[model samples]
Target: MAERTRQNNGNGKHVWRGIVIAILAVIVLAAFISSRKGEVPVRVDHVTKQDLITTISTNGKVEPMENFEAHAPAPTTVRKIYVREGQRVRQGELLMQLDDADARAQAARALAQTKAAEADQHAIQSGGTQEEVLNTRSELVKAQAERDSAQKNYDAVQKLAQTGAAAPAEVREAASRLTAAQAQLKVLQDKQQDRYSRPEVNRVEAQVEQARASYTAAQDLLKHSEIRAPFEGTVYSIPIKQGEYVQQGELLIQLANLRRVQVRAFVDEPELGKLAVNQPVTVSWDALPGKIWRGEISQMPYTITTYGTRNVGQVLCAVDNEDSRLLPNINVTVNVSIANKKDVVTIAREALHEDENGRYVYVIRNGHLERQTVEAGIANNTRIEIMNGVQPGEVIALNSMNAGTPLRPGLEVRAR
Candidate 1:
């Protein structure tokens, strides 16, 4: 029994020793793997001589260079819409017609009032109307005749009195009759001369002027009732339907010359300094995929404003749309070409880094990273122009394959 127990103990000792040896082998292998991981895998690119284009992209809205809008001249129903929306109309072509019956009636009433005022003004200037002047003249003539007759009777009575063929009382009575007739004639002449005072004449003239102005306003309203295209343009908006009642000053129609359009681009504040008038611009609309319109900077922003969460400046670009496909108020993407350089030393933008010293990049040489300071010129979203410090044909590190790996000087790297 003692011999059998010793045999079992010996087998147990061997099993423990094998298990310890296997654990030591695993520890050595793990150390070897850790030493290999010191060299980090990184993305790399070659600095090459190529054309570089720096552009600023932002959102914008289209607007017409020349636009027109019409409103209802009065509270009236729309009589007819002569031109449909999107129809091109020539200058002086009628676009819409409103119910002008009221307008015409108003105009007629104004005309009648104007004529009456003018007649009154003329009568006041001439002392009276034609009929009144004639009546005054007739009365004056009768007074003059009566005065002459009285003078003749008075002279005859005086002569009789001198010849003792007339009594004194009769002569006196004839003189009194002559005097009364002369007084009546003088009064009529004074009445004609003092018919209208200065204030009265001025009041009448003012009335005439006011009436004429009213007539002109009425005529203007009548003309506007029939809306016409003042210039050649496309009818873009017609808010009122035929026979629809609208109030005065309500919007009715809108049209614009769409051959030439303006793009109001909202550029972020940081990009404003890179913009200038006459810079080339390209615009694209999501609604029309793959279609691009070319333009130039026509105006620069005078002030900065908040747009959503970003501070932006409004830049205006003039674009040619001979086909008129770019409509007003359509949202579009605008790309302003800030710089276009040819045959320049360029590198991938991800390779470039900046710190307190200056801008820099990680140059790869002999499987190791070297921190090289660089002067950058024009840059786009994915590429940058290296003015100096980094020459063409040099390999540069973009980033590490592993997120936890950081790039540093003298660090060993394996290009991926």
Candidate 2:
């Protein structure tokens, strides 16, 4: 019994010892792993500066250089429509015509009146012929003779009434006749005075002028019935149809001059300051891939719009479209080279880092990676200009290294 108890105690002691040894082994193994982790080298990359040309990209739209809206000059019904949308037209080409029946009638009436007035005016200016003048004189003589005979009869009747040989009624009737004859003689005298003074010609000339003015107004209204293109262009839209009633100044069609296309692009305000007139620009359209259309800055909007995703100034560029296939409102991409430098030091943009202090970069020296502050300028999406604190052919770390690891200014590293 004593031997068995002693054996069990011995076995318990051995098990405890084994447990302690296993625990010690685990601790030592963990310590070894920690030491190995500390010695693991971090992976990094290098960067070097090179010359880069800075560029700005923006979305723009293609537009026509000139657009015109045709409108009805007066209220009328359309009689004829001569052109369709997209039809090429020349200046002075008849686009449409309005019903001009009333206008024509008015013009005809006015023209006849004008002709009559003109004839009267000519007669007045050329005065009466010698034969006509003589005839007028003869009529005046006859009127004078009639007046004298009536006066003689009136005087004789008055004398007879004083002698009671003529009735009072008869004497009154004779006096009325003499008064009528004297009135007639006065009218003849006035007519003679006008003819000699040419006053009648002046009155006729005034009548003729009034008729001529009416005629001219009627002709002008008639001309308005025929609508003509004001300039050479393509018809973009036609809103009215034949027999459609249109009010004055109503839009009829849209005409656009497509000889040259204009692109309207919004440039960043910061970039606008660098742009100038005649700056060369490259334009691309998704509709026509691999084709680059050349253009130049033609105009810049004086006003700035604050409503877009980015507040920018509007600029207009004129592109030569000899083929005339380029139309308005096409989506376009514009790449403008704002600045270019030759043989200048530049670095990949990813290699640069910044904090509150300013711009900086990670540089490797003697196998050690260190953060070096840098001055940057004219950076683009892919690259940045290293103005200072960085040299050409110097390797720079692209990402942050583990601080707890043994990374220092002179530590060796393998790029991954």
Best by lDDT: 1
As for candidate 1, its clashing pairs are none
lDDT of 1 by residue, 93-178 (tens): 99988999998999999999999999999898777999988888899999999999999999999999999999999999999999
Q: Which stretches of candidate 1 lie over 4 Å from their true place?
A: 1-38, 148-179, 198-200
- Compose the digit string of candidate 2's lDDT tens values, residues 14-44: 9999999999999999998775653425555
The RMSD of every model to the true structure, in order and in angstroms, is: 7.9, 11.3
Give lDDT for model 2.
Answer: 0.79
Off by over 4 Å in 2: 1-51, 55-63, 77-83, 89-103, 116-232, 267-270, 284-291, 303-312, 329-335, 342-344, 354-358, 364-368, 373-375, 387-395, 398-416
Best by TM-score: 1
